[model samples]
Target: MKIATPNDRLKQIMKERNLRQVDVVKMSEYYQRELGVKLTKSNISQYVKGTSNPDNKKIQLLAKTLKVSEGWLSGYDVKKELVVSKSELSNHFDKIFQSDKIKLDLDFANQKYENQEHKLTFLALLENFDKLEEDKRKNLLHYSDVLLESTYQKDEYNIVATMFDNSMEPTYSEGDRLMVSFGFDFKFGEDYLIEYKEDILIRRLFFENYKILLVPLNDKHPTTTIILPLKDHFKVIGKIIGKIKTSP
Candidate 1:
């Protein structure tokens, strides 16, 4: 459909596309009620004679029926190109990935092992998943004590984690994730991802005055904070330096 006499352009599109005037009515009502109308003549003439003119909305509807742009119907679509091939899309994707860098986001304590090996090794952790029986989660607590015995300072626990639970919402939402560094400097209002009571995995952590508070990301959810009284057993295991969400 072009901006010539509406009758002439309508006839031209009908001839070129093997479409009937009634087909235009049907197409105009796409995904809508069926239209039953005569089509011998006077279809496009109603608009051409200035007896009636389509508003912007009707023009858009008519253009959609003709598989053309509303701009084309109004004589403005001539400058636009509307189609692109799959190869063009592939080329576009290639251009962006060419400069994308994949870096290892490791904990500050593990900064000594920043090379690609860390990524490979960290991913190796996944291989052990299947071997970790469901009931073994509690047993893993034993490993924590043994792992903590190393006393390598915060720098040695080179891993970061985010709490995985819906206990926090809105403020922390169920899926809101965070990044943590074992050596992350404490800030008054900032939160930390950490473990409480060896079993409670939670997300909100803040420092006020001299007390460290493991607040829930969402106050609406159940949350509690423990004050460190210089007891290693009652301490933050890791700083939630980052999060990789697996589900909502």
Candidate 2:
């Protein structure tokens, strides 16, 4: 028995897809245009030969182009398919609704509302509800619940989102449910969920004179700094008030 390496997975997928090294290089160009990352013929050759491994960004691009899971491509023993079953999605949402932290009224659809805006929104959703696909309807209902919870809840922390990376390891691991409050008043030494360019990151904040530093708890990741005047693309989505740990 032998352990599978990324090289093995890469070769396996290439063979399955009937793709050549040149084909991969050409296909990667399409993703590079959008991701602004380069993957050359040499990079692909080295990856297949086990001479080198692809970095995180390249791994993502490769996964998307090759149509496989990042974990699987990285040689992890996981499902190759990225698709989630309808039952699994339903179970995930059920956990959210059943959580004690959330107080979303499930019967809002039947209850009468005095607010004209709320009434109109619910009416519109009801009118077009049947036209939407099953998955879209579920997403719309979840969005509506979150929106209502944020609007009516007295607490500052109204939104709930899952942490997707290990950048905040020890303090917050991946799959942890983060209770985030929407605000722009950034306090130093606090953890925040921020939108930097196209990526959402969870980082601890530190102010140094005229610069704002985004520091990760995991020292493997380097700290990012932004000057006092934030760029148009940079935005602080919210402060992380609390987190529900999913793993021990």
Candidate 3:
């Protein structure tokens, strides 16, 4: 007969997701870096113990990190799911591609193909590309290279690299072929292949206070922090735009 409090909802969701206070601490660190909201293990413990409540900005950060709705996290009688708007999705895509040097010309493709069937065929080819035999895959790759060479001049952005480590696992596997865009423009919250201290590594970038945080997706790996004004210590090889899995 008692109304649930924000602490109660937070405890419920954390229990449901098997997230401990320490896990929240680590996860909230990521949001802290991205959203510039400060959170600590002590804060999480206080919230869990119902001794303190998070402010609006902290509530928003928690909701995003926990993949729940802010209203639900705030103990409102709303659905727990987070509903993302189309504009939000559009803005996310814009943030990714707006700074890229290579532009995908979907309009040009439509104009050249002209027929819906042709578009469908191209889609089918893309869908079945990985399923093709080794010889067929080579042939397709050759054909693609020929088309691209004829269409556009080769640039440094044409670099493609294969993942040889599990440091970025789950999101990118060991054998995945990463399509890289060569640049030094480090966008926060996006993954990039970087060269630092003579080692080439892939990490998600973030800027906090005046430090650059290079975070690995696999938490087992350590996050590297560099001081501002990067200097000669850091070099960005490229940003990872897309990837191809070697296996199904």
Candidate 4:
């Protein structure tokens, strides 16, 4: 199969949206007006004509104006919206906008896609872990390069999360990191990162007659354990695989 270049994909998306090159020019102007960045028509034309490539910021602007996801234009089958930070944009700008002839090596791109398709993509939280409920923790701080071999689905096998507090104690303190295996099924008396009362917590879980018990390891705390029904409010995010301390 003939793979499309980024510019080719851009052209295709524009056509799908019934947009002309002039429309893209207008959108570039709009992006400049809104972000205080120079989105030149020349640059946009270069991107469309395969003469140059836009950086992440420009690509984001174009994607927004074109009403498409970045993944779609890059030919990744994705549904979620992607957010690129200004710092990341600057880095991409330095790399891509340097040369006039932007070559999209389809072979390398295809190889990278194939390599990462089965790779486990573990994500860290963008916001405070305590503030985010299990379902609300949608924003990813970053994607780890580490990959693990597993037959389970991609989401199920990906694991590990940074510690938010000293809740787990001795096992994992505040600022420590926990490696987890989402693919590993839970067992009684096992440590896991779980969601209870909308909070992501690390605790030992025990199963009993349609109920789950969350027990903390810290003996200083009076609350020995928390018991809740095995229902919506309770869920196991991942089983603890390993732990890393931030400092001595």
Q: Give the local distance difference test score of model 1.
A: 0.43
Considering every candidate listed, which one attains the maximal TM-score? Answer: 2
List lDDT for all candidates, in order: 0.43, 0.67, 0.66, 0.53
Residue pairs clashing in model 3 are none
- Model 2: CA > 4 A from native: 1-131, 139-156, 183-185, 245-248
Model 4: lowest-lDDT 10 consecutive positions: 140-149
| RMSD values, in order shown | 23.0, 14.6, 17.9, 20.8
Candidate 3 residue-wise lDDT, 1-248, digit = tens: 22577899989988865678877665555457567898888999999998999889989999877767788888888877676564653443343333221223333455567787697755654454446687655433432211223233333344455455567878885534466776447669998977787566788989999998999889988999998787757877788877632211
Which regions of candidate 3 deviate over 4 angstroms? 90-248
Give the clashing residue pairs of candidate 1, or none: 71-77, 109-155, 179-240, 179-241, 179-242, 180-240, 180-241, 180-242
Model 1 agreement with the true structure over 1-43: per-residue lDDT tens digits: 3545444444555665455555556444421221222322254
Q: In model 2, where is the ten-residue run with the lowest total lDDT?
A: 98-107
Per-residue lDDT tens digits for candidate 2, residues 129-217, read 55668765554454322442344344556456555556788887644557777654768999987777655678998889999899999
- Give per-residue CA lDDT, model 4, range 1-248, as digits (tens): 22555587787766654566765665455445455566766776788878887777776777655545676665555642344454653443233222101111222344555554533321111123335564332212112211111211232224445454445677765434456665786588988877666456678877666566677777664332444533456667678876532111
Question: In angstroms, what RMSD does candidate 4 have relative to the true structure?
Answer: 20.8
Sorted by TM-score, highest first, which candidate order results?
2, 3, 4, 1
Model 4 misses residue 36 by how many Å?
Answer: 20
TM-score for each model: 0.30, 0.47, 0.37, 0.36
